[model samples]
Target: MKRSETFTTVLTEAHAGSRIDLVLSQVFPEISRNQIQNLIKAKKVLMNGKVPKPRDIVEGGEEVSLEIEIDEGVSAPEPQAIALDILYEDDDLLIVNKSAGMVVHPGAGNPNNTLMNALLYHYPPLKDLERAGIVHRLDKETSGALVIAKNEETAEALQKQFAERTVTRVYQALLVGELISGRTVDAFIGRNPYNRKKMMITEYDEELEENPGKEAITHIRVLERFREHTLVECHLETGRTHQIRVHMQHINLPIVGDPDYGSRLKIPRKFTHHAENVLRGFRRQALHAYQVGFIHPKTGEDVLATAPLPKDMTTLIDAIREDHELYVKDHF
Candidate 1:
């Protein structure tokens, strides 16, 4: 069974003028700040008997209340057996190689057969944790390695590491254009005003107290170049939703097979017939989470894991490489 926990507190002088989310996080250190923000967004946090924005400043002696539902047992999805590619597992956590097209968790229009449901099926104990202990997520079209916590303490520790920007995640992507040098994209990202489902780079002044966008940073280095595309490695600095996809598109070098951000299928005239065919056949974003490194929550030691590129991506890359070789032999 699940239960709701309530907390009521009065802002002290030391907490006055602080952001509501930050103050609540300090007062309740057990809850992650991200969870606090979610609570604020869900209208579960009230200040002075009214729902307050996450960034609202609190004056001393103002009453604040929070209501959080805690799950004590597995509830939804009716766990059914599903295959998982396990990378590593321990008493505290587990790492999995998530396949492309698999939703990490269930949401609107995605009711079941998700990674969360599969995890619950495999590890019934995870039913007691939120989202089956998933601390972070990869987009449905992106395949990669992801970590899951086994207990509440490990989940909080992993969330803290992510919040502090201490976790390292490296991804491999095939972009539509050649990149001459490594570079970093530092931009704010938010929902597209015109299309609510999509994200776009936002222009915001850092000095503003309430910025609509979240800060995102991605560092990319070219690994290989073809006549019409480049294979690159991306290191994430902040894990905003669609961070790599949006950042790459912001620079006009969208990932290959990215239907939303990429340009219409227009193979370059210089591309070989085989290369064009391979590129056209790739239906999902050519992105893979290749490596991840973080500190172990229980052992206090560093843990790193890597997943090889999936078969589809590897086949596409091989075709592209063959084309590149042919171009080089003819020109140089």
Candidate 2:
């Protein structure tokens, strides 16, 4: 899947003063400036029969040949004897519905007892696959469908599709309040200067905006509304750090039980709308990656997987319903 595409631009005086990276950015915005520099370093980017340096100035009407390298991206972790849910498994790939509260992979302080640990224990052969066995990730709190790579080749393909935003992931959340009937929180998001741990809606400033992140789009629609809660469905256009949670908070409606970005609503820990809101005793972010769809890495065939709400989420929903119903009957 390593394919190369070319672009030839007639650099005008408009492009003369700009650096090669900036100049190409205007011509080829789909590719990043760093990627362009990578081609130059690899001697794949030539200007007038020579490898033009990064800072080199391009004159008007110069032909720039770019031999871009395209590879599907995949990531893996240190292999260990991790026991996986193993909803589906084969030689090429597998799909598993992660439970709530399980960290997807190993990280600071959580080196063991993670999804990676279970995965490692399940697929000892994945030692060679590395993160290739881990194609997509679910946040430690968010539970739902994830695709795992069995080998390096499958990992690469899944990574590429995820990077290009071709994969479809659907997350359901219970917000603190009733949201607009149908809404899309279309706003630019930046890191919180005040808190390194959070992303927030940032003001527009040249200095802060220069190297800002790309467009993050979210489509949200209210599914159900209780007295003080709103169940909503979210579709993500770009997968940035905490995209759904940040966008929801940016609009002043954070997910129920989300520690960092959620608006604090005074409710019992029993929250969330998963399991179609039928159970009780649920806590956590109240967000679930319920469904995922994509093309199979090797077969290129459409694939879709759905995960039901975990017991914790379902239990909480049912408890809330019974509690509220009883309260209303007694009060009336």
Candidate 3:
């Protein structure tokens, strides 16, 4: 279903001297800045009776008009009975522990057997909400806790928390190398011009003509160490595509089994046959969204949920630990 609505607002003194997109975004918090920019681009937004640029400066007392076409309802994908590992649920939202290899939503090649389809089948009412009430996403190969809003009010509230950087997200990852200490990786990440499928630290990559990237911050601390690998925790400050993986690679400790950002495969000599096989056979990035915490939109209370490590990651860790113990017994 498609429905168009027009809104008009007059700028106040406090809103003066701000970018048009910024002004409109604050005026209508429900509409995202990106959506506001698109409205300006499509000639659906007018400032003081003139179609203004998204970057145009706004003065006080100017009339801003915006027309938005809301698309929802029938556009939702069909429900499928795919199973989900739910961690928490309430009237407002639910936390799902998404398994590795399950796509979050219907996209391009993945049209069925997605978390969205599963949510719709499980809840049914989710079909009426946008993107089946999904407020965030994890990579297709990333297994972890994810939030799904049950209504528009909850969706907007949760989105605001994420936009304001209040929602807490922590990941557990196994890296290919041992990190000596915990550090924060603050870098600008953007699409690789050379490889569109991969993300790169654009600000640090001198070859890029210009940086079309956003700042990404990840605080990593070692949880356990092995002869050739490190289990670490990652706290995300900004949600960027491939933020953890790219940042790890930037620090020369790429996550194990990450096909894109991982370094060349090298099995350490200290590993036993089982350990070597485990390290070599792992196929997806050793990253999991271990926990997510946010305020309940409906109950006004803090909510936190944790997901257990998957079987593959736990098994791999066990093998590496055993090998490390033997290496330490002989060499140390």
RMSD of each: 5.5, 8.9, 5.2
Lowest-lDDT window of 10 residues in candidate 1?
25-34
Output the number of the TM-score-best candidate.
Answer: 1
lDDT of 2 by residue, 133-220 (tens): 7766677889888898888778767766775678898888877766758788777665576776566765556963344443578888
lDDT of 2 at 112: 64
lDDT by residue for model 3 (172-247), tens: 9999888988999999886677886677896643563434465689999899999889999999998877899999
Model with the higher lDDT, candidate 2 or 3: 3
Candidate 3 residue spans exceeding 4 A from truth: 1-76, 204-211
Those runs of model 2 whose alpha carbons end farther than 4 Å from true positions after fitting are 1-82, 130-132, 208-211, 268-282, 323-332
Which model, 1 or 3, shows the larger TM-score?
Answer: 1
Clashes of 3: 0
The per-residue C-alpha lDDT of model 1 at residue 50 equals 96
lDDT score for residue 66 of model 2: 78
lDDT of 3: 0.86
What TM-score goes with each of the models? 0.83, 0.69, 0.82
Go through the candidates in order and give the clash count of each: 0, 21, 0
- On lDDT, the stronger of 1 and 3 is 3
